[model samples]
Target: MTISSAHPETEPKWWKEATVYQIYPASFKDSNNDGWGDMKGIASKLEYIKDLGADAIWISPFYDSPQDDMGYDIANYEKVWPTYGTNEDCFALIDKTHKLGMKFITDLVINHCSSEHEWFKESRSSKTNPKRDWFFWRAPKGYDADGAPIPPNNWRSYFGGSAWTFDETTNEFYLRLFCSTQPDLNWENEDCRKAIYESAVGYWLDHGVDGFRIDVGSLYSKVVGLPDAPVIDKNTKWQASDAFTMNGPRIHEFHQEMNKFMRDRVKDGREIMTVGEMQHASDETKKLYTSASRHELSELFNFSHTDVELPSSAKTWSHLN
Candidate 1:
């Protein structure tokens, strides 16, 4: 995949030449034939993957989860999902993949963790909980025309409805950018970031994982003050506003911190890759994200080309006429 350079000084890295195959573990293959694919199934397909000319494989989340949003709502990053098999099975698959000369990577869904996660459970236990600040929780802006408590802003969830969910016990609302069960993490909290690295990123990197495909990498930092998004349609109840959320003020800083950590992990010269999944990022942002001088990410997944339709406005898409 590398082209011959007349200067002979520039050469693309192995990853640049790698043909990566993405595997949705739940549906790839079923070794046990229990109607669900497991680690054993992945192991059984090494020959096929090798023959298919893949140099690396990116497996979707198989971590312990409630399956609310498939395995994206991770409850425990260190443990394997029961239906996907045990931790040993995961290690076995990694070993087999390495033996076959293929790199192994996994999805890093750090933007949000399952509400069932112990961290989230403690965060929601009390307003005074030490972990309470680990998530974005805010007071209601005020009561609506019907006297119902309104969320802090008019921001809508990616799935639908308001992004804020009221907590009965706390009498406050917590932000859930995707599913209500997947509460967004507060990367602003240094302790929270440290814990994520120790428990999620570092843990896997140390256990032989090549790298991560960071989920929602650009949406980690949100605009402070939680301003109401500009309403696109007067009749529509929800606002389609990523201006305040996507590519936030501290995104570069956060990514740099992550890059430093990853570099430190593989100081022994091992190749580690990181690709951020950023939706709606512009070409300029994409360039800055992947530039070596920026030390942000190895690459980025921009949804522009993949999306079948283009958003003509915030309210509607402009499909091919």
Candidate 2:
């Protein structure tokens, strides 16, 4: 059996034909030998990557974070993690990669950020604070017999616990789809999305990154009304949140908005590329994500069969439904 292009007349994107090299900066190379990799180390090896016939370099997150979840829990979107190197070092790496004729793609982890991030801090500061709406927060459903506050729903953290973490200061629970240290951002807030696009997406593009590898891309949208995930795992108090959070109601709208914002910043003579790490979305739904007319994504990494997060009983498509 063989497969052919359904749209042979469509223009081929550069990334479609280019070979890519994925780098985890923390352990890739350590220029200063602080026991961790830095931007300078990656920069030093640009020619080596090019020599290997890689047309693009995809670096994992090196953004400012508490490192609770490696760099996935971004603390500051605009700053580089100090051990990784300074902002100057990052810019130089991007410039060096471009001079070598290789595209640079950095991780964009917007689904959730570190609890220590300024946004999350301010959000958890007080319930009435202006930024409180920047993350998902819900009042306790009720108190249990032991007087402990129950989470708003039975959603489980990807790391294996309650998805909602109680905040004593605010008397509310904030959602953390991953770890308690990583608070999911509220994409429903237009202000938050605008600021994120400008600072996180636009700044990198302006400084010379060719594109981004969006992390947990399909989980951007939140399930409306904070519904409980189906109790697929009978033994656990919490269940997988994919049913509510993945490929959410506003997923396409949010992606299109971000895609347009990214495209509008293009200065001509330069083509921007993007690939999203997606999960729990159907093949038909993925078509909407990469459709040029839809302006959602250039490409997407589907985590269906490739995802090791699912249990054996839950791995089948029937279980997902």
lDDT tens digits, residue span 1-321, model 2: 122355877676678778889999989989998999999999998899888889999999999988988888899989999999999999989888888878899889898889999888899999898889989999999999999999999998877789999999978999998889999999999999998899889888889888898888988888779898777878888888787888999999999999889889878657788898776678899999999889999998765765578674355221011
Per residue, candidate 1 scores C-alpha lDDT tens digits across 1-321 of 242445665456667668888889999999888999999998989889989999889999999999999898999999999999999999988889888888898899998999999999999999999999999989888987998789988988887789989988788899998889999999999999999988889888887888788888888988987788897756667676588888999999999998898889775577788988887677888888888888999888766765556443443221111
Q: Which stretches in model 1 have alpha-carbon errors above 4 Å? A: 1-11, 145-147, 306-309, 313-321
As for model 2, its CA RMSD to the true structure in angstroms is 4.0
The number of the candidate with the highest lDDT is 2
Question: Which residue runs does candidate 2 get wrong by more than 4 Å?
Answer: 1-7, 307-321
Q: lDDT per prediction? A: 0.85, 0.86
